[model samples]
Target chain A: MDHYTLLNPLIGGILIGLASLLATVLSGKIPGISGVFGRLLVLATPDPPSVAAATYGVAGKTWRAVFLLGLIGGAALSFALWQSAAIFRPMRPLVVMAIAGLLVGFGTRLGGGCTSGHGVCGVGIGAKDSMAATLIFMATAMVTVFIYNRAIL
Target chain B: MKAGKLFLLLVAGGLFGCGLAISGMTDPARVIGFLDLLGAWDPALLFVMAGAVAVYGLGMLVLRRFASRNLKLPTASSSPIDRRLVIGAAIFGLGWGLGGFCPGPALANLGGLRAEALLFVPAMAIGMLLAQRFFGADS
Candidate 1:
């Protein structure tokens, strides 16, 4: 692999791992972004929460909101300071992104977690379900890519 | 709110975002570039995953040992591999392949004020709401 391909990605992955580990140690909470965001959405809804939502008290909600704000704010701060030129746009249409986003939001909740939660943190912790979920994620994503690129576009 | 915890949270979030940008997760094209197995497949993402998992695995092992020794580390529980997990993961994979933006990167990219993220994030929030409604209040 090229130097760029090897160094940045490897180091970046290490950083992500470290971050997740830190979150676990500091708060005893899994740093699953999808789960955190999903909780917020569920809480925000006007309708009464299910028994599960009721269990997620004000303290948990506060931390989650703080963590999310930190995520966005941190990214913005770094982007502004370092001004990384690596960002890209959607190759697909706006409609595609929207639809995909919806699926991501819904599916992650249903699935219990996303890439960071399942693929990285879940697998690392020796969770059988996470391992299974990760395998399914990679397989289905490949199939989708094949269909989208070869058949559709 | 506890200042220390908040600061750590900020640091963790910062590290995660930096990792996403550095690992090229902020770039959907790069993500799609790897997913296109039939085409010119870039295996860089594999290295990213490997690098991440290796570090996390070591950390977890160490943490578990400490916890076993009476440290206050949080415990982890495993979910079941049932229909919800399978169907949900499948749907997520399809969406990921379709959009090239997962939850983390999508939110991180939104920090840059990307228009696509503006659309994706709100719709994603709505989708979460709808999903909870469908699955019942707790789901």
Candidate 2:
């Protein structure tokens, strides 16, 4: 705690806020990563025609794809510019990681949003559902971490 | 969509990724540390969320007044708190705690070429597909 610094996180958070703002203003879209990614998956895979229409339309696919590619490109650029921008530390085994991914994917879809969707953009707009979802997920995550630390670790 | 909108989307996505990287959210260890409430907790994430939410909240308020027509905002739903929301969030939280990665950070890490993300993203996609197919989850 003594060694913690606040400048970077603040700046980064502002950047994220600005990104969301831009997305909304320019494209009229909420930049929720899970929703964006999930819809893109629907487009790529052959699913029920109803599902495809219900989610992403043909016109919607290009922007989502470009946005995601930009996300990846931005991250790659950051890593290249700042070599220490990301340091990978494997906490759990590969199996655990895969399972975690599955849960995240399923849960976000089922729940209707992830941290970006609910936590940031949803909360930003003062949506009650987003607020409730955010609190529920945060509490559950904290409890899970507590159990993981005590029992798993 | 228009080329202009597409370009802006790209820029927005890039900014989002840069924010994640710069804020250290791309690191699962840092995320887990923040979540480890019982252990030595780091409040950096709180500040990040605060800063982001504050800006976004204000921005949306002003934007709605000026450009509501042009904006394709998410429609407000009338659904109440239900089992689907609770169960879904709980399941997502469990996975988040286990892996210490959310969708945003996980994808960003994949871009950074992290081996963990490589394994995680595919599984997440599969999970999303399953949820959509079997559970009729909304995308």
Candidate 3:
């Protein structure tokens, strides 16, 4: 764990927040990618709110497709840049990793928006729910880490 | 209008992804490893924030010139920063300190196809949903 590792959390947090704010100010969307995905998954149903009137009801299927595609495209672009420097570090046990993934997906649905939706977008505009969601989310995380290190580890 | 917004998002997303990658944020190992320092930690990530701010500031200035009076969004906003916020940021920080996965990176890492994030993300979502129901989401 050199320096870049630490930078990820703090700097990452700030950049993420900034990106979200800019996206909101410029595009009027909060950049809640996960929420976007959710709409995409459930787009089969007619969106209750009209697009112009509702602000963020259900987006068109085509737009969702493109949004999802942008996610992939962004990743690809980064991978292309970091292609060589990629450091495949030692991984947690596959079992552990898998469990973590399941937990995260479950948490996302339960939480409403992952960190981006609540923590960044929500917090940016001063949403009460985002704040509460982020608080509980963090508390649970802290307890889990403490347990993992002191007892589980 | 939707098309226009999508175009902007597409560009922003690309820039965001690039920022994460270039800032060395896409790699969780880097983050988890860094957390090894409970305190007396490096502020490298802070610099990343500064850089990103510079970029965002310039971007915002340019965007302001676009002269779009602005269309209202479906997304919710909270101006007061009430108890929920104080509590939420603390909780989010705790989770972040422990898991090294917050909102943006969680999504970006998912885009990178990291299997670990696959789990953390869902659990995170569930957590958010729980907040929405109990706390009453910003409808």
Candidate 4:
């Protein structure tokens, strides 16, 4: 019974959802992970509207730079606090990680935000859609894992 | 609208990321292990959660101090969750189970991890666009 973190996946999922909810409520914006990046990448386009819009709201580079900074800083800080365990877990080749990354981007866009968008924030706001989405995501994830455990990996 | 606000969003991202990292979320191995159960179930992921939940709960307390007609939001914007949500979630989960990647981690990976992200992130975006188009966000 190693209760080191004193937390489990179930609770972790719930907490993650809750944080998304809180952020959405506080900011008056949904905490959609991909959406945040999409906003960041607006500069990829030379289109005036995208550029203007990006300027109107949070400056694309500024926000994106901060976002990246936060991510890296957070990872590094966590590593510092908890050592390697906190920073990263063993991973496959860069190619494997890259493939996983792209699929997720597609999923977030197709699905509209990541788990945080639906699983946590939408849920907190009492949206029916979030609940359904969260359920599906969890079930699918479980099934996917079950399959991997049995068949693939 | 101004440099200041942009700064805030970045700060928020960093804060959020730091929180995620501190909770041991940056690593897919931990996430996968948690899902493994008998094979490699690590319950430590729970602390990452406890801290987050506590933060949210405390946030509510502090939020009340700033609560007004609009609360923390300049305008109380709300979206009603609906059927499309279920479909979106299912699609998202299918990807997650396949590769333990999510939007947050995906974006964070722009730092590196090229090929995996190139494929997955695009798929995720497609999923989101489909939702906005199909659902016609009302609000």
Candidate 5:
């Protein structure tokens, strides 16, 4: 890869790390996208009263909403400024993308985290479960990619 | 939850988006490129993750130093390895492979208002909700 390509991921990684650090230090949160978003989903759903109600409370709900909004705002701002910051193309059919999203959503919840929570923040903290989850998911991702591109495609 | 904490959370979220966008993680092509290991594999994601882990690992150390505060992070799950974790991760990996976008980048790409990302995000939300409703037992 070119030097520019290498630099961008590193810089972005640092920014993400800083964000994770800030969230943990200031609010004792993990800045995990799935965890944060999942909590909001559970809260929004009209499920029977459960642990979430007591856990999220008023403050919990409020902060999560704000944090999610900030994610969009930050991305929008960067898009406007960078213009070419995001190169989004639909590489697969709509059905495929939708199904993928569903699996990701379900898997993250079932697994208790996503790339951000389990791979980044979880591994960073040296949590054994997170480490295991990351390793398993990483291997699976590679294998899936191999199968899709090589076998299926 | 408080105003100050809310503000901090907002900043954190924004910064997280910034990192994703800047690092090129927001681009599905880049992610797919990285995953295409047998072919023209891109190692950029490896470095991106490395940088993030370095900083976050240090942050964990700092938090550990302040362990007396009883910091109960939501990210911490005391559960062991089980069928749920393995199966869920495997399915998630398959989905990620099918669609190059992960939850974080997909959500962040909403900033650009990409049509495909729009389609993906809602579907993901529905999936999360479904999992919570049906699979709350497993978690």
Candidate 6:
């Protein structure tokens, strides 16, 4: 707690909110990372559904690709410009990371959203489903952490 | 017209990534610290969520006034809370708590070319494909 600071998080959070708002205003789509990424994967298959095809279309895929690319590029740019000391601290083993990734991918798809989708955009817009999903995920995460720290670690 | 939309999306995505980086959410340890309620908890993430939710909520309020056919906002799901939602979210939480990475941060980390992201992202994509295949595309 002694090393905690709020300014950066607050600023960063506002920027994220602005980004979500801009995406919706300009494209009329919720910038749910999981939905965008999941649908992109589906679209890449040999025989994508007509619904997905129609939804994504040519421009749809293009925007999704660029948006994702932008996510990577933005982070790179941030490191280059400021916070040069930022580094990834591996908290879990490689095996744990892989398993976690699998669960995240599966769960977000089945659940319909992630933090940006449900926690930010969904809860922001007062969607009941998003709210429910957020609460459940948050609580579950806390419980998991509690168990892991006490039992596993 | 199409190019304009794509450009805006790019900018939005960039800002979103930058925000994630700046807020320190890109760090798995920081995320885990927030979740470590039984341990020494960090409240920075709480403020981050508060700021994001408040600003986005207010923006949506103004946007709602001008809602039109052109504005394709996501509509609330008609279905009530079901098993899929609960199970899915719980599974996601387990993964999140374990890895301390979610879709947005995990993808963003790819920018740094971190080894963890390289491993995590591909596995996550595979998991997504598995879910779509087994659960049907609609899920």
Q: Candidate 4, residues B1-139: lDDT per residue as tens digits? A: 3666555655566566555544455566776666566566766545554444455445554565666756554121244454445555666676676676677665444434445445556655554444444443221
**Could you tell me every candidate's TM-score relative to the true structure?**
0.90, 0.92, 0.64, 0.70, 0.91, 0.93
Q: Mind giving the per-residue lDDT tens digits that candidate 6 earns over A48-142?
A: 56755654577667777888888888988876666521546788988999999999999998888899988999889888878998999999999
Candidate 5 lDDT score at position A8: 82
Error of 5 at A134 (Å): 1.0
Residue A43 in model 1: shift from native, Å? 2.0
On residues B76-110, what C-alpha lDDT tens digit does candidate 6 reach at each position?
55656788888888888989998999999999899
DockQ, prediction 4: 0.34
Error of 4 at A117 (Å): 2.3
Q: Across residues B9-47, which tens digit of lDDT does each residue of candidate 1 receive? A: 878888888787777777788788888888899776777
Listed for each candidate, the true contacts retained, as a fraction, are 0.69, 0.77, 0.25, 0.41, 0.77, 0.77
Looking at candidate 3, what is the lDDT of residue B54? 48
Q: What is the C-alpha lDDT of each candidate?
A: 0.79, 0.82, 0.53, 0.53, 0.80, 0.84
Model 4, span A85-142: residue lDDT tens: 2444444455555445544554555455565555445544445655566667777766
Q: Which lDDT tens digits does candidate 3 get at residues B43-78?
A: 545455455444444444455556465634434544
lDDT (Cα, tens digit) per residue for candidate 2, span A1-153: 112257767877898888888887765667788888888777444657775664577766778888888888888887777644655567788889999999999999889889888898889888888889899888888898889889988
lDDT of 2: 0.82
Worst 10 residues of 4 chain B by lDDT: B130-139
Error of 1 at A28 (Å): 1.3
- Which window of ten consecutive residues has the lowest lDDT sum in model 4 chain A? A1-10
The alpha-carbon lDDT assigned to residue B55 of candidate 3 equals 48
Please report the candidate that would top DockQ against the real structure: 2
Cα error, residue A89 of model 1, in Å, equals 4.2
DockQ values for all predictions? 0.67, 0.75, 0.27, 0.34, 0.70, 0.74
Cα lDDT tens digits for candidate 2, B43-137:
76787788889999888888777864856665445657688888888889999989999998899987878888999999999998888777664
Clashes of each: 0, 0, 56, 44, 0, 0
lDDT of 6 at A32: 88
User: Residue A60 error for model 6, in Å?
Assistant: 2.1
How accurate locally is residue B119 in candidate 2, as Cα lDDT from 0 to 100? 93
- The TM-score obtained for chain B by all candidates, in the order given, is 0.89, 0.93, 0.75, 0.74, 0.91, 0.93
